[model samples]
Target: SAVISQKPSRDICQRGTSLTIQCQVDSQVTMMFWYRQQPGQSLTLIATANQGSEATYESGFVIDKFPISRPNLTFSTLTVSNMSPEDSSIYLCSVHGQDQETQYFGPGTRLLVL
Candidate 1:
């Protein structure tokens, strides 16, 4: 099992500003995924950050807008660039467990762009 944690549990940012959220895990993990959960909506896969490789983003999410960094096996960061009001959402960090089937999520970083 991996213990995951995210920085700045919550934040309020101005439109056009960018915020970088950090995710740290207690143990090394192979696959780390980023997700966004909008108000009253289900989680949407944002991207997957694999250590030593570029992050693979899902449909509708561009690297330019959502840059991800996987500096090591136990750490990753997701930056929301040029944020707008519509970008207000709860961002989560998840890592695959030992079995690779189960995933553990971190306390999300909530962002509200005004």
Candidate 2:
């Protein structure tokens, strides 16, 4: 099982700005990822945060737009840069559970670009 150690669960940001959402797991885990959920939509995988290397972003996503950092086993952060109205969404930080098959997600940061 994993627990998120950060709060402020959500926030609203202005356009052309950026927000960094952090995730911390209770135990050391190997895999951590960032996801985005648009209004009334499903989750989209943004990237896989590698512990010591650059994050592996999904097809439509890019590192320059969504930079991720995983400094250690249990901590990571994802920054959504140059925000726009289209970028307004719920950003989530997740981790593969200890069992591996399951995944746990943080409460998520809700950003609204104005």
Candidate 3:
């Protein structure tokens, strides 16, 4: 299993601002995904960050609003741009485990836009 960690575990930001959340993994991983969990909703897939390619965003997510960077197998960053109250949520990063089907998630970055 790989150990995952996220920066800025919690933050309160002003509306219209942007925050960049960093995700780091102890071991190399081929599949890394970003997810968002709203207050009372289940986790929603944001995008998939592949090391050498542009991130593939999920249906409702656009690259312009949520830009992702996967510089290497063990590190990725997700930026919430022009954030608003509606964007306030718990952002998580996950990496596929050895079994591929399994995934390990980081603590998550909780953002509160006011």
Q: Which stretches of candidate 2 lie over 4 Å from their true place?
A: none
Identify the runs in model 3 with alpha carbons over 4 angstroms from their true place. none
Tens-digit per-residue lDDT, 27-80, candidate 1: 999889999999999999999999999999999999999999999889999999
Backbone clash pairs for candidate 2 read none
- Candidate 2 C-alpha error for residue 51, in Å: 0.6
Each candidate: RMSD? 0.5, 1.2, 0.5
Q: Which portions of model 1 show Cα errors greater than 4 Å?
A: none
Scored by lDDT, model 1 comes in at: 0.96
Determine which window of 10 residues in candidate 3 has minimal summed lDDT.
96-105
Question: Mind giving the per-residue lDDT tens digits that candidate 2 earns over 14-45?
Answer: 88898887888888888898889999999999
User: Which 10-residue span in candidate 2 carries the lowest summed lDDT?
Assistant: 4-13
Using lDDT, rank the candidates from best to worst. Answer: 1, 3, 2
Looking at model 1, report the run of 10 residues with the lowest lDDT sum: 95-104
TM-score of each: 0.98, 0.93, 0.98
